[model samples]
Target: MTHTIRRLLTGTALAAILAGPALADETIDITIVNGHPPIFLWVKHLTETFIPTVNAALEGSGYTINWTEAYGGTLAGVGGELDAVEDGLAEIGAIPTVFLPTKVPLQNVTYNTPFGPGEPQVVMEAMDALYAQIPGMAESWHQYDAEYLGGGFALDNYILMTNFPVTSIDDLAGHRIAAPGPAVNWLEGTGAVGVAGNLTTYYNDIQTGVFDGVIVFATAAAPARLHEVAPYVTVTGFGAQSAGALVANQTWLQDQPEAVQEALRAGAAAYQQAYIAEQTQRVAAAMATIAPDEAHLHTLSDAERARWAAALPDVAGTWAAAADGEGLPGTEVLNAYVQILRDAGVPLVRDWSQR
Candidate 1:
């Protein structure tokens, strides 16, 4: 063949190769588990936003994920998701760090330091900053055989729901109120009996007289219909909290291709933003639904909020000391977290780190 003809043939071959698929199409199966059902925004977004976001990110790439979702105690109950994911029962999970305070104490910084900010976005941002600033934040998950992706899912400002009216801190006296995990500490000096409870059992437990009321976030209260059982709604402003994040089994994540890992992380970031946006918008509506009658709703006075904050013991200091005893940087996490909120101009009834 002539030189020109040979060159033309080579160019044609190159064009054909470029026109074909860049890489072989690959499919990966990932199971995502959560204790709560789809009704909860966090779980709902995993299916509606996270999964789709991952798929969208992999569009041009030659990879796709076939997701198996186990929620509402199908594979694990509330507070059991960390174990499920760590044990490799599922490839990924939305683990609520609030429940695993002992296992992942660093992630619970917001919970220990209450009366900060009522906005979920602010709390989420602070947690995200903490994760980046403190090495122990991510190490906490690694030690559990899980990889922490950046969801930073946060609960809205916590409120009080009671069967009876609560005009002030005195009203909580002689009442048995249920709160989840460390939030139970918020009741320390309020004269109320604090019982450990979660959203799954709040309504039934209250209705059955197991507890007279609950410390809960509005986003979940309306859907759980806590209003029917506890008609009085008091905006306590105990502050929004970092509950959990998207996590993956460490081994499972390490075994995946780099592209797959990036996609999952990207999906997590999108899920966080979407979940918080939807949750913030739903807060007011949920409060309205929970307190349809004007007489049933009450916003605690600023003075009363300050009084309640002062009434509690130094829960943050105590928590930090315990974590420090475990050889973690609990004090640094606390101070840094509070500093972040202060820098952001979030009003605080009391500086928790100072105590």
Candidate 2:
């Protein structure tokens, strides 16, 4: 070939390569929203630990990020997360299924097997791996046209924080209790009336006796000052649920740079692992300061947990079936989660009928 022709060919190939990836610093813009107050303990984690970790992870890559944090309804409220992500109002958020049960039923499983495991690390890992393997999980997200970034861990299991004493199960009867989403189901046998409540309102609501008490865990209770209002904190041994998801718009995700995609996945994994580890020890340490004095704890015997488990419906099955019908592997994901939890020696709360 002539020299001119060879030069032209080389120029075209270089242009194509440059157009492909172009090793250029890219700025990724996303929004982080939460319904709870900025001072809420869980919110602190999302702002402090999670966001910084993400920025640090991308530091050397010359990848710039613009994170717009809109909390306390600046963007959306607790029940509005699914729509926000689906509608492209926000990019990253911590949504509670307890708040949006209709949008995400599989999430209710987080509360269903409430008394699953005590340790945060174990529960976090169990749910994380479980969601990935479970059938129909992704399908549920796709229904809203979104993707899951995989931090399926949470603050802690639901505890009963009340102004009154709860030394026995019978004590919960005839009282009004607040729980998230389907968690109202867990309070059924106790004969207590369940109401919808979130972390932002529980402290004041409990103090005012709007509800006799709120069902939540230490990681959340501390910041909300539940110990001050409801001094009695019951250690129900319920595992934590998914705190927040590093979700992306399904359409936007497909357009992200491959490097950005990998970074996003790795960042979520690191955040989940680090958050679970810190929360496990933080909760115990937080409780240690209040135990045997200001606050009360109740641990169910293996027999008692079994009784509770037996009483509850097969929520996992219900969820998996729904997701399966929607073409998501809800069943498989749930089963794989149970296996991982079992292998980790995390206590099995119940076997969903779908299994």
Candidate 3:
């Protein structure tokens, strides 16, 4: 062949090699479900930040996803997320372990041991590390046929929103106070009656006198306008909580292309960062709107906070022991999480692991 012809052939081969990866690209379908609607900050981040981040990362990659978002109880109601993913109704979900205490007892360690760390960033860092370090921690999700991707602590700290001002613990006598999940345990020793309630019905419940007030996070209570009804906001420092997690169907995840799997994992990590950043920023910004008249924010004296924490039963020990009985490293996780808080200089109202 002539030199010119040889050069032409070489150029053609180079062009094909350059086009190979793009030609190999594939599009896959993914269905994401959240029992709760996008109104919640976490779910909002899932749709607004998580999905966009995943899609952006996959751009120009060999795999693209056709996402189907099923939220707002369209596919499953609250507490139905675990089964929805396990049954293959959705490929992934934001499963709130707080709601599935019986099904995923181990993940509730944060809820069980309260008043440790009030910062969401601190709790999130500790929880994320435990999920990686402790044996069988992630396997808790495996039991439900789901893979844990990533999760974060939802609130900065728990507070009280009530119609009546809480001047002292004695003031809670004979009153009904609502809390979500194991949070009711925070109210155990106080004279207040703890009722199981969630944000969706808090307004109605209080309006109908189902409960006199609620213990909730400031970020959430502000947006939901809990201040409108229960104008007295007491900063109880009940500690931040591990509310939910990003999980994918184990079988479906295993069958996915390697790139797709990585994208899902990447998306979850991004979601955690986005969520914590928003929560951290939101606490001050949201509270700015709920000032004196609209709502009164009072911090429970450190002495009072410690007294409340000390008065509660050994919920952490009980929880850990129950987990150990079921063949899990509950004690190890509990210790590690508490130590993480201590190392971060978080003021603990009670050292749960020590008890």
Candidate 4:
């Protein structure tokens, strides 16, 4: 009995010595917010990809996170994501930079130079390369007290969804068309009055005749059932857009352990992969629904597409000039973006960098 008791005590001491410190695990609480609801593919990725990826990455580490997710205006409204993170209302968020162009102007590089590539992955890759090559691009997020993680721009090649059939560019004359973000500029020379609007309100607004049509992607139009309200989907091919990103408060991010920060970045990368895959599939599937005759879908003729592109003012140059006035490397980014796409063999409709 004495020998047994002595052995037990020795084992206990050995265990305590081996433990070194208390090894108390740390738990981090983070709140993620998005202006748009989960129905949007990007928002869905927050729950399905970002959160899960981060959680999985943290496993077996000495730290874990307890996530509190607030989406769809629960925490912030459209164009309010930057403020939410800057004010620490939320530690992290997927900010749609298209809505906050003044704050994240560099992020809108794709928006300024439109009609480049149709594939989201190509644009995403170019943007990623820009973030690495251009210091100012990443610094734009720092200005908002946020750190940018890898993700994508969700907007695919935009089309015009209208109540009236659009057989030609002239068909849009004097019609009040809804356009989200800088896309309103795309209608400048088209003779269409572009009213500012978004996906969430496109249906009701169109139903009530607030706007005759909306400039939107097929994937979004299909899911929102815009076809039910507006049967005409004109494939204008305005361009795919890199419009949003996952950003975390810089103060909060800087305070985290290295492991936690890495996990967050990993989660963001996963989000980019998942988003591109799902968005590609959705676009293809949505195209099937928008048939030639049944859905009143019309792909603008090549000649007409070029005519429309030529009629537009030097919008990309104007955008780059504005950024330069604000002390950003606007022209450099613009030139690099166009060059990257050109090198990748993306057939651009117009040479936006020529101006």
Candidate 5:
């Protein structure tokens, strides 16, 4: 009787040991620091669409991802977010790749060259496929000790909007224009004063006269009601951005069972596809409202656009140099990406690294 009782206790202990890790794998509590503004259309996708979709994907499997709102500064803010993730303040967060250009320069390769067609889907396709081929791409995340489970493209190309009437590039000079970081360099000789403002703040600031004009993309513009402040919109012929990634902490991910990893990958791809479709519809709806005269839907003239492209070399060079110091294959990967963009029919004035 004593021997039988001891054996039963030992068997129970062994069962507990075997079950603990698997149970932990089935449930994960991750906080998604909502990089987008709560009201923005993209936010809807992140909160309403993505969470439920990912949950459904993992439903029967008993695995789950818990995302909590950490809107911009509401939790970690722009600069400190990667640190927030690293320290485990929040298990997971959405970061804008552009915001941390110095810390994550390699991710911004698509932003430097802007001549690709501005559609969101194509830009997403190129970046997704591009990263899979580049060994350096995956390695970019490793240095930070994070795992890049998957990445999604950012909203498509940017558009120009202004509080007052502006018709031509000549009109852009001497205005208080808010430009996204890398593209801010593109605006240099054009004579626009660069004010560093992000999408989250642009709408409110634009209405209040913090800026007379803004360089922003359409997908976000409509939701922000940019038209209310800036009646004039210009669809600058440029590529969309691939600026979001779903990264997991290397420490945490390594301990997970193989089944959990597979589920996360599939969910990431689904989120990317849904975001692309959702954004495409929003951009179309936004574009439909403005009269042709008011919205100026046309590409920059070839000669003028050539001048714009010529201005990109310094921006790319500066970025590559910064990246190299971090021990990343910056110059090589940056140049290779540029060539890929060109080979795919993107327009280029000067190669950032090599043709």
Candidate 6:
């Protein structure tokens, strides 16, 4: 019994010596920022899904992240997230590419080619394909000192919320409407003057007559309470758009350990799935919340959708040409984008690639 006890103690000491002293987890500080508040699906996922996912991934990895979440324009205002991350004001951010059209024009392909797929996941997959196919697609973000982490932050199918009823595209005539970023091109030939605007100002702008209506997504409109101001919800089906992405400061990301980098990338992937799933589930509910009465909602007919698509100037072609002028792979990206949709069997109202 004595020899056995001695052997057991010796084995325990040997194991302890081999293990060495316990090392405390290396704590890394990371701050994530977004312009929109936690109420929005994207931002909500960052807090609920992304950070948690990163933390979960880091488990037992001998590292821990001390996270600081700056949201609701606390760290960066709408359209300023890219600047915030690039300038190192925040280590990471949800950069709305729609707001940075000139800086990241290729990311705006969906906006330029409207009336495509309504499903956000389809649009996101196409974007993923584009990023892989076009080297310049990633290079564009690199120019801003930001590393694009694919979170696939896509907007739901865009709808028009107006104070006036839109029985058809003709009803949009002579009214001023607001569209975000390159989406203004969608208003061409509709006779409605398109003013550049975003979700932050859509409610007040319409209430105060800044514009008659706003081209916005249902998920956002319900939260922004645009329904109270613009009760007429026209389901324009402008198509789900790849609007923004989760990005990190390139310098900061480069400095991170490989495990840390992998954790962040994994977190981004999980965030994308969570955000899309929640956004998709909320879309119908949001539409109902916006227009509770059947009279308040009008889905533009397929014919009207086709007419609207036909009426627009060759926005995709124009955008691509401009990108090519800048020596970026604009035309290539556009063609690849449309082709991906075609291959996926998404019914397109007009093939922007044909133009």
lDDT (C-alpha, whole model) for all candidates: 0.92, 0.70, 0.84, 0.87, 0.70, 0.92
List residue ranges in candidate 2 displaced over 4 A.
Answer: 1-26, 60-62, 289-295, 313-330
Full candidate order by TM-score, most accurate first: 4, 6, 1, 3, 5, 2
lDDT, candidate 6, 7-34, per-residue tens = 9999999999999998999999888898
What is the alpha-carbon lDDT for the whole of candidate 2?
Answer: 0.70
> Which numbered prediction scores highest in TM-score against the true structure?
4
lDDT: worst 10-residue window of model 1: 21-30
Candidate 1 lDDT score at position 299: 92
Residue 71 displacement (Å), model 6? 0.8
Can you tell me which runs of candidate 4 are displaced by over 4 Å? 2-22, 290-295
Reference-based TM-score of each model: 0.93, 0.82, 0.91, 0.94, 0.84, 0.93
Ranking by lDDT: 1, 6, 4, 3, 2, 5
Q: Using alpha carbons, what is the TM-score of model 3? A: 0.91
Q: How far off is residue 1 in model 5, in Å?
A: 33
Q: Which pairs clash in the backbone of model 3?
A: none
Per-residue accuracy of model 4 over 33-136 as CA lDDT, tens digit each:
98888888989999999999999999989998889999989999988988999999999989888887777788888877766687888889999999989999
Worst-scoring 10-residue span by lDDT in model 6: 143-152
lDDT of 1 by residue, 1-355 (tens): 6999999999999998889955667889888999998899999999999999999999978888888999999999999999999888999999988888899888888889888799999999998888899998888788879999878699999999999999899999999999989999999999999999999999999999999999999999999999999999998999999999899999889999988999999999999999999998999899889989879999999999999999999999999999999999999999999899989999889998885
Clashing pairs in 6: none
* lDDT of candidate 3 over 1-355, digit per residue (tens): 6999999999999998987854666888888888766777888988877788888888877788788999878998878888999999999899877888777887888899888688887778888888878868899889889998775436678888899988678789899999988888888888889998888789889988899999888788877888888888888888888888899999999998777778778888889898888888888876666545533767789898888888889999998998889998889999998888888888777889987
